[model samples]
Target chain A: MAGYAVELRAVWKRFLGPAGETVAAVKELSLQIADGEFFALLGPSGCGKTTTLRMVAGFELPSDGEVLIQGKPMGKTPPYQRPVNTVFQNYALFPHMTIGENVAFGLQMQKVGRQEVQRRVGDALEMVRLSGLERRRPKQLSGGQQQRVALARALVNRPQVLLLDEPLGALDLKLRKEMQLELKKLQREVGITFVFVTHDQEEALTMSDRIAVMDAGVALQVGSATQIYEQPNCRFVADFIGETNFLEGSVQQLQGGQALVELPGGLSVWASMAQPVAVGNPVTVAVRPEKLTLRPLEAPLANQLQGQVVDQVYIGTDTYYSVRLASGQTIRVREQNNLAALRQGAQPGDTVCVQFVAETASVLTG
Target chain B: MSQPRQSPWLAALSGLVYFFLYAPIVVLIVFSFNVSRTNVVFEGVVNQGPCGPFYWYCELLQNRSVADAARNTLIIAVTSTAVSTLIGTLAALALQRYEFFGKKSAETALYFPMVTPEIVMGIGILVLFSALFGWVNSMLPPGLRLTLGLGTVIVSHIAFSIPFVTLVVRARLHGFDSRLEEAAMDLGAPPLTTFLRITLPLIAPGVLAGAMLAFTLSLDDFIITFFTTGPGATTLPIYVYGLLRRVVTPEVNALSTLWILVVLTVVGLSQWFQQRE
Candidate 1:
């Protein structure tokens, strides 16, 4: 690897609140995006994901700290001076100009030659699968087509890094899914680093090679999708990424990197320590619904517990069971609706043994 | 698509209101063709005059003072519209985009001219100009002394027209998506280039509407023009007012008809341009 395509060194962005107090939108967050990597800043609203994206785009400067693009320290460089492009959420296509002009805008702004602009604009449009609609204005295009035009407009510049601020937020669910795959494919084809900000966890998981999950102006965790979902470092990251069953427990013993935690009702389960924990300290064991197997064991087993199925929902591919443990803690289990599983499907009031994929389950301290 | 059902009485009332508004102007236009110099009675179209059916229009063209007034009106209207539109658009942009000291006060003050009586503002401008001229004239030589003329009238017209232009342009700027500007900047256009390539084109309709409004106001202004105008700087309105003091001739009617036709054509052209965009 040559260097990071983009880096934020302890960036902080503070804004004046409506009541005249300083509000830190982004608080001392640092990240390094790899070259040609598809990275996502995933968070709920008010979590400073958009602010971080804007800071990278140079539209909003950091109140403190540094943003480096391609190993160059960009200290107070205006957005125009930055070698980056942005795809705004609304697509922000120029309504007054034709699609040809909109796509050619960045090239013309850089004072590219007339013939070069025309050829590159045509190529960029074709790259986004919008070759024949150059003469049409923005209003004349459909929503998905406008989104493609927006992509072409940015991709035409061929910047080192492309910043997208919730680019697919406005699309319908079906279109969003299609565009998500198309964008990933296009990013791979172009081989430019992408740093996209979004609130949708599935979109991040489905597209990004690495994801930084943020909450309340702080990046809680940053890792790959499997690492983030299978091994969350914190309770917030675990809950934010996907539905996780948390059982309150105290550490009984530590072995290798795993922990033996004793739950209420004298039940014990073995869980992986994503973050180190002290023996006799209270922690929460997080296990995903799909990771838990609901089967009746011969007797009792390590990483196994007893529960009665209080609710079961058949959702075509999988059956979701809400099982209540003897300690009265509710845990949801998702099992595939195979023929054998369906034949022995447990309904409400049926006692079943819930097995944990202990190697993948996380014990979070906070 | 289903439209709301219209009431016949409401339609009749609206028609009556339109007639009430346009009847006098229509009468003024029709009377312009009268052959009689006294426009009190509707004389038949002049088939015997040198210009055939356009007798009064010919007379209106022959009036040298009226020609001077028309020329002065055009100069003042065109100059003030151009300058006011430029300055007012900048003012609107600053108000909409930037935050500075006294911004709240400035926002409130922008609508003062729109709300204040034109006659009151005219007198205030007249007094202010007189005071300024009085101060400067005392220091300058008599041969090169400044006086109230087209300059003062244009200045006053620009002052009053700014609030209107700013209001219209500011309203347009409110709907503008600032992300377009950022997108341009990210594409390597500096702030100025982004404004020129993106911001200006989008808000152009609002700027044109404001300019048109300023132009019409300058063309038809009487009170403000009256207070600031001097000898040889009389506008068409002032000239028409002067003529009404002694005689009510068909020349005035012909001038009014021509003015109405030009304003209509300009408005129609602007509407067409907006639709074309």
Candidate 2:
């Protein structure tokens, strides 16, 4: 087996819509998922993440480029011939078969002996915590149980990779969180590559070892959750991952790794440059809401702004204050509800100072 | 639970509708046991009650022509139902799963036999078979002969019955999720294995219902059978028609009562199976 379990080399997919117009679903997308890695493709609907997963599973053939499984090119291979299994969005458990039969389907297809099939099916069901209910039909089980059965069915095959397309999308938020941890644990125990696709950012962040953030049929960035969140490479990546305050400005000077950006109202701020930016070039400095600290206007800080608190929202865990700067730009600041006495001191129309460090803000060129 | 009170007019209307529907059937059942040979009048003198309960039933059981006609009807019904169900299920699968040129036209052709008047369909089949047999006979040797008989009647029954089977099975296919098949293939089952194990069992009820309908239709057909049959291919409906041409007899009523029971049993069985699923 190769170091990489699955690889897509510059894959492209095109479809003709119902109106006879061509649509590019996935455009020159290249990704390599390593063995025993939990990789996530995170994107919203119409971003072609699902199409990429389908190509690797052999459900779709790429219009251009090649798909390789374990370093062997998959050319015109049917889904049944591929060494992979998928947990569909709807769970897709066989309505006519019992849970046991559904789990044993892959083994029976390989002409395994009856005793071995029975033992493996039992063990798989037990692994999913559905051992006693094997004889029950899919309709008789709850949605979460049905999802477990789908997972067991796919995992029992012990394929080189497992593809999950939004498997937790149908569940409620509480159950989705529970299954997120469960799925990660199972992936580690099985030691097989899991290629998961989801539109939920939190799910991708919490579960994936690495994430490929996609938009408009293109992968914008691929990195760890902390890397993608803290040090976004572009304006879109910074905006999409979490809430951020963007201050548009022109670069005044570049010294070492820091660029000085001059905002409106003659306010100069230093930000760490993600890419090289020449002097006088347009740039945007992005600072996370949580990284900004609110202090009294008289306090002196390295990177400080004088702003008035225009609006305040009190959520249970955190309070958000929308501060309007002297240049008429509004930026949000999130404060944890650690001290109840501190929240009563800040109110709308009150002048406040926002303090942040130069390393906390990232400079984006485009 | 408290029962809702029925209005007087609604109660009367419901009773009248029931009477209108079942009065002829009741009369038929009652007269099947009449002692008189004639169907129109009771045997007892004026204002007398029915004379014997088992008289015509016994007569019908001993009739050789009735037995032969029953055998022919059973053969045609069973054969046509089996053949049409297989063909119609394949047609339904094709229509549901694939797209091709002239698909709409083909679907419309399937419904043509169902909507056309029975007399028109019977005449069309008669003309078509006669012309086809004429051509074949002209090409054959002199001693061998070809004629319209049981084979023609069975074929005509199958032609009309297929549309009904297709309609029922297609309705079942509408509720089916195509992802189940994809999931099967994802788990390493080939296309044929997936269909046999997953697709077939899910749609079995619809196929059975279609077969039952086809069998009942073939069993009771009169116009098409009358036109397509020859000397040795008289089915039950045609035999009853022949008996009616001379005079109405208690034997005819007895035979009709038994046929009603068979049809009811088949329909009831189909409904039971469908409800069970």
Question: How much of the real interface does each model capture, measured as fnat?
Answer: 0.97, 0.88
Interface RMSD, prediction 1: 0.8
Q: TM-scores of the models, in the given order?
A: 0.96, 0.94
Minimal lDDT window, size 10, model 2 chain A: A337-346
Could you say which candidate leads in DockQ?
A: 1
Q: Runs in model 1 with CA error above 4 Å?
A: B1-16, B270-277
TM-score of chain A of 2: 0.96
The DockQ values of the predictions, listed in order, are 0.84, 0.78
Question: What Cα-based lDDT does every candidate model obtain?
Answer: 0.91, 0.91
Name the lDDT value of residue B144 in candidate 2. 82
Model 2 / residue B123 / CA error / Å? 1.2
Q: What is the per-residue lDDT of model 1 for residues B1-277, given as tens digits with 9 covering 90 to 100?
A: 8999999999999999999999999899888887777878887876656787788888889999999999999999999999999999999999999989999999889888888998999899989999999999999999989899999999999998998899888878888999888888888888889899899989999899889888988999999999999999999999999999998888889899999988887777656644544
